[model samples]
Target chain A: MSNVIEVKNLTKSYKEIKALNDLSFEVTEGEILGLLGPNGSGKSTTINCILSLLKYDEGSITVFGKDMKPDSYDIKAKLGVVFQDVAVFDELTVYENIDYFCGLYIKDKATRKKYVEEAIDLVSLSEFKKFYPKKLSGGLLRRLNIACGIAHKPKLIFLDEPTVAVDPQSRNSILEGIMKLRDMGATIVYTTHYMEEVEMICDRVIIIDKGHVLASGTTDELKRLAKIDEKIIVEANSFDSKYIEEIKSFKAVHSADYKERVLTVSYKEGADNLVKIIEYLKKNHIKYSRVYSERPTLNDVFLELTGKELRD
Target chain B: MFVHNFKYSLKALFRNKTLIFWTLMFPIILGTFFKMAFSNVTSSEAFKAINFAVVEDDNFKNDEVFVTVIKELSDEDGDNRIFDTTYVENEDEAKELLVDGKIDGYLVMPDKKDDTPGVTFINNGINQTIIKNVVEEIALNEKIGNEIGETIVKDEMAKGNFNIDIDGIYEKVMEKMSDETNLLDKSANKLDYSMIEFYTLIAMTCIYGGMLSIASINNSLANISQKGKRVSVAPTRKLVTVLSSLLASYVIQLVGLALLFVYTIFALNIDYGDNIAKVILLGAVGSLAGLAMGLFVGTVFKAGENAKTGILIAITMFFCNFAGMFGITMKYITDTKMPWLTKINPVGLITDGLYALYYYNTTDRFSADIINLIILTLVLTAVSFFSIRRRRYDSI
Candidate 1:
């Protein structure tokens, strides 16, 4: 697929501090590219620079093979951006807000109306169409914000932390809607600190830290970058400290940690690691309430790369 | 795009309760209060004829011109009477009237031919001032009349016409002095001191249009509001958006001004003079200046909306006070003492324009005020445009 956006050697600074340091990335057409990073790690800055909403200190950005500029009306007409902050007008109703923003790009009344209604339906905000922003709940307001941003139905959409501070149901709905947008032949650039969200909807992921791109790949490929293949957790009321040392002695066990009545062991390369731990627990007469094993997650990859959790 | 933005901008500005209160309700309420405060002041404080006694001594009786002037001024049946003169037989009786407070002052004839007439009063006041002014004017006119009579007699003798008519020369001198010394020219428009308050109120109302423009402009600048950020990202040109929003604000401001005019003219029965069209024109230009001020405050300052609003209020009230909204005396003081302040102030310009329209026979002053207001509006708009046209910012 051709690239919808390209940024080479991108750099941005806030006085003495750099916000984006040699940040480089490409968003392929018709795919969801996740920009995963902690707070203040240049995720929003990168998106702003790409959309020409900000002036970077160095490097260049191009959208649809043309240089992005503040007056690039043609490129801007075909692009949609949902900023991290809710940007809908409080004085307008949900429907009016959507219609107003959509009218910015779509001049036809009939088409704008149809698109506004479709957007409301996509974000499940049809029931609250007549409600003002001040009357809507936080999650519903977020949905309205999304609907307003995407009502124009642009070929490329930028969703910057669209699901921040939302309930599970709203987050799920937002993720599903983004997936639908990707399925409808639009290139999507999604930014969030939620690793699970990146894992769920992102076709390709780029992990960023302190304004640097640490790693980039599919979810599974990124996960492989972790030092461990499998992780096991055992919950018990009582556990001897010696068992952690014993677990670490296992050939496949990369490390073991025990705290707060739970013992976790990570395997470097192993199958049936949970079974092995369960058999060992039984032979040692150690009573465990539950034992489980799972594949390494993107958080593990981030921790391996930056020595910190993705949320930190 | 302009229409779309304009339509929504109107809706947004109209729905803003804060903007509505400051731009419409606040000025109207303040005007109502001003009306109530100044309703009866003009009538109660109007000028009344002063009372005084004149001693009919030998010198007073011998001066026919002075006696005739006093009789004409003290004629109760005359329309131009300025004094309630009480004739006394001697100086003792006039002094008794002055001491008893029955008269503001008494006019005493000179005992010697070379001495001037004198006035006596128990207290200094408007009535005493009027009496003193009248006595001094009569003395000066007598001196001028004597001088003219001598000049005419000498000129006639030089022409060899020795039968000089002294009475005719005195009559001509009196006529000429009367014609030349009439300094007060009553205008066709009545002197309404209360109208100054109303004019300043109108000026206040016009400058209050700044609030509406500030709110509208705030919604158009990317660094000021979230909605502005959304607008900045749109494909439409920034000029169209800014101009359309300002036009909507201007229309609303004009409507508010029109309502004020209707209220003050019809309901309160206040007369805004005969030049209603010029008054409206001044209000329109003044409102434009107000909008320009708002645009300047909104874009030039990096402060928040509330801070900018505080600054606008400070500016509007400052100009209004200087324009005599608080009191007519302030307007006079500013106009006489600090005319440059009034020249630069939008509210002062509007108030002075309205004052000129109501009080003057010509439109020269009013036209100059209008021109100054338009120039001020253009300058503010140019500066604000320069500030607002910047598409990129160092920070949001």
Candidate 2:
């Protein structure tokens, strides 16, 4: 696949603080490129700089094989952006808001109408098409905001935390809609702090922190960067600290902690780690209500790379 | 793109209830209150017949021209019944009537050959001034008539014609003089001082249009609103968006002005003079100045929408107060004391323009006001354009 967007040595500053520093990445054609970072980690800033919405101190950005500038209308025409904040007119209804934003790029009335309807359907806002923005709920308003941004069906779309405060159902619906967009053969740059969202939808992931790209790969590949290969949790009525020390003594055990009657153990690398822990629990006569083991998530990898939680 | 932006802009502004109230309904409500407050004032301030008495002595009776003039003026059936006169037999009787406050003053006929007619009043006021001015005018006209009659008589005698009808010539001269004075009085009566309140009301309405433009323009600035960021990211030119938004605002402003004119004219019985077209023209241009000012405030201020709105209100009210929206005396004081302020104030220019159209015979002052308003509009528009033409910002 060819690159739809290219960034090299992107640097931005706000007075004394650097918002982006020597950041470089490429968005391949027809794929979902997740920009994952914690709060204040320059995710939105990077997207803005790529879209030419912000002036960078030093770097070059290209969208669709052309240098991006504020007046790059041809590139801008094929780009759609859903900002973090809902940006729809309070005076307009859901349908009208979508139509208005779409009208900016699509001049044909018939085409705009069709596209606006399709957007409403994609966001599942067909029942509330006539409702004004103020009358919609938070999730519905977020859906409307998304519809307004992508109504024109651009070749490249930028979605910045579209489900920040949304409920699970709405978040699932939004994620599904984004996947459909990606399936429609359009390139998408999705930015979020939620690692699950990036893991579920993004074909490729770029983890950034402190204005620098920490790691970039598929979710499984990035997960390998974690120091531990597996994590185990056991809920028990009573757990002894001595057993946690014994679990720590295991050759594959990286770390073990017991807090609030829950024992969590990290394994460096091993197969049947859960079976081994279960056997040890049975032999020790420790009555555990639950025991489970899971592979390292992107958060673990981010924690390993940044020395802090991804949510931090 | 322009049409699309303009269409949605109109819808957005029209649906904004706060903007509708401030720009359209607020002005109408204020204008109604003004009409209610000034209704009695206008009626009370209208010209009324002066009450006075004349001491009917031999000289008063013998002065046929003066007696005829006074009788014609005091005639209730005449069109120019300027005086409600009661003749007294002697000076003492006239003095009693004046002291009784039944008459504004009493006119005494020339007591001696070298004496002239004089008016006496207990207190000096508008009525007293009117009586004094009328008496003095009659005296001046009589003197001029006498001179003219004498000149004609002398010229006729010089030409060796002794059959000169002096009485006929004097009567004709007096008749002509009275006719001209009556015409001047009629023209002077057309000056409606209370109309200043209405003129200022119109000016206030025009300036209030700035509120609409401020609200509209604020929606198009990326730093000020979320919608602005969406618009800025679009492929369309910023100038088209800004201009289309302003055009929508301008149209709404004109609609508000039209409603005001209609309500004031038909409902409040306010007369904006015969030049209704010029009044509408001045109102339109003044609204343009208002829109330009709003654009300037929206683009130049880094404050939020509410803060910018408050600033615009302060500006509009300042200009309105200086132009005498609150009271006409302020307008008079400002015009005389700070003529330069009036020249620079857009509201003052609009008010003065309407004043000129209502009161003046020529359009010189009105034309000057319109030109000044246009210049102000252009300057504000240029500055606002410069302020908003930037495609990118340091921060948003």
Highest DockQ scorer: 2
Per-residue lDDT for A253 in model 1? 91
Distance from true position, residue B89, model 2, in Å? 32
Candidate 1 structure quality by residue, lDDT tens digits, A120-221:
989999789899899998899889988888999999999999998899999999999999988988899998878899889999999887788999999999
CA lDDT of every candidate: 0.84, 0.85
Poorly placed runs, candidate 1 (over 4 Å): A238-252, A258-261, A283-287, A307-312, B40-190
Mark the regions of model 2 whose C-alpha exceeds 4 Å error after superposition: A237-246, A258-261, A279-287, A309-312, B40-194
Candidate 1, residues B128-174: lDDT per residue as tens digits?
Answer: 64566467656666766677778888999999999989788878887
Q: Assign candidate 1 its CAPRI class.
A: medium
For residues B197-277, write the lDDT of model 2, one tens digit per residue.
778778877877887788778767777788888888889888888889999999999999999999989998888778899
Q: Is the docking of candidate 2 incorrect, acceptable, medium or high quality?
A: medium
In order, the first chain's TM-score in every candidate is 0.96, 0.96
